[model samples]
Target: MTQAQSFSSTIFRRKPVVGARAPGQAADEPHLKRSIGTFQLTFFGVGATVGTGIFIVIPEAISMSGPAVILSFLIAGIAAGLAAICYAEMASAVPVSGSSYSYAYATMGEVVAVGIGACLMLEYGVSAAATSIGWGQYLNELINNLFGWSIPNELTAAPWGVDDPGWINLPSVILVVMCGLLLIRGASESALVNTIMVSIKIGVLLLFAAVCFTAFTSSHFSPFMPEGMAGVTSAAAVIFFTFIGLDAVSTAGDEVRNPQKAMPRAIVGALIVVVSIYLLTAVASIGAQAWTEFSPDDEASLSRLANSVTGSTWVGDIIALGAVISIFSVTLVVIYGQTRILFAMGRDGLLPKTFAQVSPKTMVPVNNTVIVCGVIALLGGFVPIDALWDLVSVGTLAAFITVSIGVVILRRTMPDLPRPFKVPGYPVTPVLSVAACVWILSGLAPVTFLFFGLWVAAALLFYFLWGRRHSKLNTGPASSADEVSQ
Candidate 1:
């Protein structure tokens, strides 16, 4: 039979719900193969979650909640882990690869799937921009420490930063654009590389922890609840943003040897590690100085602590250098996540197929990735980090809440579906997850909530007007939407 005839034949033949495979003619996913193992997955989670928020976000969190910011980390981790568990089941059941976009497509209607895709674009795209700006601060610090050379703060700060006044962050935009090029050129990160990067990040944090411990004193904890209940709640919301990447642990549903066992184990394991590290770092920082003293302008705040401890600039330099490496990986991971969400939408025919079409030349979605990179670069260059963080938090919380609810929806709709690892305590666990996310979301600034509302409205509007009519799933897919047991 000719290729077209074969394609037609394959289209009508559907696989069972379990072990469903991608259509042979749907186009190869990419040139880069799945090389990540469980350990790698764990590291990707740690690497992506460890540095950006902990080192830099603390300044804002400290200012918001005083020393009680540690509680926020715990709260955020619990909610994120719950979401990840829900995601793992859905991902395993669907047997298709993508994040919320893919899961929403198979289980929810095409319209919601597209809306989720839009949400994802915000989550990843702005996140990439956010991570880059955070990266830029450390870059400037590193330069200053190494050679006493630094870019003028004007070039680095967005014109509208809460504290720093600037029109745009030129360096941040440049960094995102560079990462886009790397990804477009088919540059992929390996699990081993991510694991090593995670190690470097953890080591640096440990160094910060150790150095601070040397100067630890109980006096810093005197005003532990200075910001009171409201401050703790508000700080939790901001701090919750840093813990968003903890779900990276569950994205590898297929490659994991024993997904049901591996998925939950890894999720819990990664969460524990992340929380412990955060607690250690927070305690160390708080021990070393007053909780109210953290500077919003200090991007390399943890490294600065090390500097103050040793009275030598070398420790800060080391921290900055490690941040540069680790955050580079973060940019890669965040950008990668953003593109994948769009790609899933494109493949589902909700957005332009071009967005999902993998380029034969690069064996990746070159056009789509490039477009995403361009948009993020613009934001990075123009948007301030503080402005970016709230938006990210809203997107994440909304997505997490949806996933938590999705767990209940899927359980009720497909009760018999094999879930590699069913979330323990089912209805209760999912409910708790949703509540936690909403509580955190409640802490968002009014402007951020308004911005989030506008974005979501745009997505739902697009879905109602356009995405619903173009869903690929309407015709039937080559594989099962939800299939595996976990």
Candidate 2:
């Protein structure tokens, strides 16, 4: 091969399911411990996803689609559900840490892997930051209701968030740090804590739903689809990040026990729970309060709605408390997913090796966790939450599209590959998954498209300059076209 052809081949080289890691690496070479089960895995998805968007997305969705925001929820849920099915198949077949990045690497090539990795990083990292920002708001609300005091706006606000700008978001910074500490201890501990948080939050949301329903009026939902299909889809795009955690389950492929069975179950289970709760809450909130009354400025909108419906501060306090607990779990899980993605990249030599180093004592990527926390803290503290949400949805939806495409590619390229969980409809399912995600993508703002394009460009540039030269597949012995499993 000519020099140019050799370079092209190196860039496009695919990792095999087997021997994709450093050649001769032992089966027990200390990857993340496989301790997470189907149950905890489901909570990881619910925990990471629910708190981030549900607490805030209702008003945002309502602001766009009016009472028809309920339909927007369904649309986003369907798209997310479809993509999650594809993710299950990929996670089962690849059974790796990087989520779609790992899937793309094994099925597509090194370049696509880098691109997908960038998208996943954006999804998890930015969502963590954004969710943490909201955590600060709920913390203040809880404190205010319980003790007649709250964090000062100056300390609680992000400098960049024009909606309620402040010098720094102290509560958000603290939340990010606290979650990072929990993650450093180990995944099992983190998962246990997250599951508890998920339970509490779900119960709180249900309570809110029941309370709001007491004041339900059929008149509120009369002009459903007020924004038409365009409005519903646009709202769906805005709130799509609420469903982002479903893929967090796939990112745990390396740490999951009985991954082939656990992954698909966890993803589907989490999806059902998340979607049901969101729809219920949306219906109740809209039924009790006119959709026109939802203000984007209300931080604890659900809690306020409860307080208004019941005419008591105590109920709102409880909801705020739940938000505090649940958003913390969201931060914890998202940071965990982000670190694992970096760990996968590090293992591939696409990043500095320190990121891949699992601490001997904890059996987790301590260095990777710390780096993720620091970056997330900075973003959460300084960036406006408003700026982060759509960006997260854009990255997540893009990654979802990649996973759907990867399913089709893998099925054709490796038809007999062991897939413990096949997407039920085969070609139709994956194709629909891609189309659904694309439809959601169409609703994103032009500025979001520009920013995402720039982010992808930067990621590709880094790959050529640094990751390309250091990638393990470029230096390791050739891989066998065989399967590896957790």
Question: Top TM-score: which candidate number?
Answer: 2
Per-residue lDDT, model 1, residue 21, is: 31
Error of 1 at 250 (Å): 4.8
Give candidate 1's TM-score: 0.88
lDDT of each: 0.70, 0.85
Report lDDT (Cα) of residue 274, candidate 1: 85
After superposition, which runs of candidate 2 have C-alpha atoms over 4 Å from their true positions? 19-30, 478-486
Candidate 2 lDDT by residue in tens digits, 257-311: 8787898899999999988988898889999999889877778888888899999
- Candidate 1 lDDT over 1-486, as tens digits, reads 999875443333222333433221134433223445566666656766777777678888877777787787777777787777776666556544456655554455455655666666777777778888888888999999888889887888887767767767877887777777776765234455566778888888888888899999898887778878888888777777665565445444433455545555565667778889888988889889888679776678877878988899998898888888778767776776666566656665667777767666655668877898889888888777767888877777877776777678778767887776778788888898888888887888899978877887898787657765665645654443343122
**Model 1: CA > 4 A from native:** 1-32, 162-168, 185-192, 249-265, 477-486
Model 2: lDDT of residue 248: 84
